[model samples]
Target: MQQKIIILDFGSQTTQLIGRRVRELDTFCEIMPYNKFPKDDPSVIGVILSGSPYSVHDKEAFKVDLSQFVGRIPVLGICYGAQFISYANGGKVEAADSREYGRANLEHFDAENPLFNGFVENSQVWMSHGDTITAIPEDYKCIASTANVKFAAYASTKQPVWAVQFHPEVFHSLQGTQLLKNFVVDICGSRQDWSADSFVETTVAELKAQLGDDKVILGLSGGVDSSVAAVLLNKAIGSNLTCIFVDHGMLRKNEFR
Candidate 1:
């Protein structure tokens, strides 16, 4: 079975964007609320906790039980997600004098960690959080730090967990995409086998097994998804599949010549 990434959403507005970034890397990724994640899945290659606008210091702040992931899959926590990991694992966080929002520099860093694998000191990163992590869990080692937060980035050798105090999935973070790619491709060790073609083949086989010798009609618009779906159906049911592409009188000049 191909390995997959599981992103535990903590209600971050940017959570879906995280999945988009992962998919952009040609790797299959899924997003589920922290509470709705599957219980047992050794095939789960990695977990990324998304940044939320909520503050972890509040009593009713969104929370996800990390007990199931403590020592298992490689985990990366962002912004609010980082605070959750820190506070849950015996670290300390306090409401900053003010929200630390906007661009900041990674004054100090460790290039060895996959998060900063290709980043240099003084790299710019996007930051937006009211609460800041001042300390980290006892088992975790601090890999990167900024002036404002002593524990900017940490890795737990004992738990395969890593957390960053920045929004690494955002385009403003200069090297944000690289950081994600390193974590997903390098640390998670995910295969680059995820693509439209792979999905088409898998779906075709599954459909054939489920509807053997059954006549089926598959219709699709010319959009990417519909096109792909139509191809899968055609592969599975062959001549039995019929596609309808209507030219709603909205074609570009010379489109149907």
Candidate 2:
């Protein structure tokens, strides 16, 4: 079984970006829908809860039972993930006086905390949410804080669970990648064994097995993404792979086409 980090997507636009950022760390990860958690998978080493557009108090908010992950596996929550877990438990998450968004600097933080392992004094983080955590349960301790947001980051004293209001996966966060690295590499203790080379080698083998004597046509957008995908598919099944490209046509295409 291949070890991987499981990211529970709560319909956040930046959720895939988080997956990309984690993979950049040479660690394999999967983005599962919010409610569809892989409870019995021992291959999962960590879990990341992605942000969402809906509030925790919404009439139609998506939710999951955190009990399945909390003490069993390392957990990292971002934005709505942070709020929902807090609100669902005994903590208090309230509507911010104003929707806080964009760049913010950490005014106070515990430099000794595992998550803030290489963080400098003025670490900048990207925030995008209308709600904020006012208080956390007694078992959790504040690890990082911004001038406006007191609960910028928190961690469980008894377990490896942690939560942050910022989006470290975004580009604006200066040390955001470092934070992710700390959580993934330091806290979660991932071997850092997965990489693009390994991904290609493993994927090609899997594709070959799954598509035995089968023809496949993958859509291409003339972008590096699909182009590389075409290469991988071609490697997997030889001439059995075919692709369709867009016309009118962005040579530097966006995947959303």
Candidate 3:
């Protein structure tokens, strides 16, 4: 089975961007709302907590029960997500006297860590939150920091938890994309082995097994993945396979024209 990554959204503006970034790595990923996660998917290798507009000190701010993933799976938190990580695990975060926003250079980064694998020291990172992580849980260790924020990036040496104050999914983050690639490709130890060619080959065998003399129809989206899937199915079923393209009005400009 193809390994997958799950991004848990917390009402962040760039929530969808995170998924886009992961897909660029030639791997598949899905963004599920905080409440819409599937209960059965062992292939999910990691969970990313998105930043939110809510402050940790606000009584009406969003809250969730993360006990399910704290110690079991790899979890990464960003901005408000990081704060939540600290608070949920017995750390501290409060309103900053001066809201730190906009461009800020990271002071130091642990190059040995996967998050900083391709990142150079004194790299510029995008920051966009008011709350700061003052203290971290006993299990978490600070890996990188800027001048204004002491706990910029942290990870649990004991568990599969990682958090960062910067927006790695944003274009403004100079080395942000590299950081994400390091985490997903290196830290997670994903083979990057999943690809459209593999899918096509696998589906061909599966289709031959199921539809030897039977007929089958595939709804193709003209997408790379779906196109490959269609070819695979066709190779197995031959004349028995039918390809149908459905026209939907929701596609971008000229997508269906």
Candidate 4:
């Protein structure tokens, strides 16, 4: 089975981008809603907590029990994820005197840290949070700081937990992808073996085993997913796979011609 990275989405608009970045590194990932987070599984090599619109101090803010995977698997929190981690671990996170958005430069960070590997001082990052972590727990050490936010990035001294107050999944962050690569590859030790070709090979083998002599019918919409599915099925069972394409009468001008 391919190792997987799980992302707990707290309703961030950019949460999907995190999964996209991880996939770009040839690593498999799945995004689950915070409330519907899955239990600890061996296939899961790491966990990422996505940002949210609600503040950690709010009564109705989304909550989850991090004890389930905090020490067992590598955890990387972003924005609200960072605040939630700090607030839950005897740290302090409060509203900033002024809202911080757009691009910001890192004032200082530990060059020796694994997350900051290959990252330069004063690297640009995207910030979109209103609350900042003012202090951290005894075991947590601030690793990166921006001019306005004190604890822009932090890691636990005793655990594999790390966090950042900026949106590293966004393009505005200079070393965003590299940071994710470090976590998923270097820190988490993911094999980074997931790819479209491997997916097709495994899927075809499974389909052949499941349907030895049975015939299958698939609907093709000329869209990416359905087209890919049809191809895989055809490769698996050859002539036993039949494809049906329906005309919805929504095609563009001269589409059928």
In terms of lDDT, which candidate is strongest? 4
Tens-digit lDDT track for model 4 on 20-96? Answer: 99999899899998876667478999999999999999998999898988999999999999999999999998998
Query: Residues 140-237, candidate 1, lDDT per residue (tens digit)?
Result: 89988777777778888687788899888888889889889999999889887898578667888899999899887655546566677777788788
- 1 or 4, greater by TM-score: 4
Q: Candidate 4: deviation at residue 132, Å?
A: 1.7
For residues 1-257, could you state the per-residue lDDT of candidate 3 as single tens digits?
A: 67887888888999989888877776667788776656578887778888998998888777778876667677889898899989988999988888878888889878777678878778888899888888999967899989888888999889878899999999888988887887777766566776656756776887788778998788877777678777777788788888888665556777876
Error of 3 at 87 (Å): 0.8
Q: Tell me how far the alpha carbon of residue 96 in candidate 4 is from the true structure, in angstroms, after superposition.
A: 2.1
Candidate-wise lDDT, in order: 0.83, 0.90, 0.82, 0.91
TM-score, cand. 1 vs. native? 0.80
* Candidate achieving higher lDDT, 1 or 2: 2
Error of 3 at 145 (Å): 1.0
Q: State every prediction's TM-score relative to the real structure.
A: 0.80, 0.88, 0.76, 0.83
Q: What's the distance in Å from true for residue 136, model 2?
A: 1.0
The per-prediction tally of clashing pairs is: 0, 0, 0, 0
Worst 10 residues of 4 by lDDT: 248-257
Any runs in candidate 3 off by more than 4 Å, and if so which?
A: 194-257
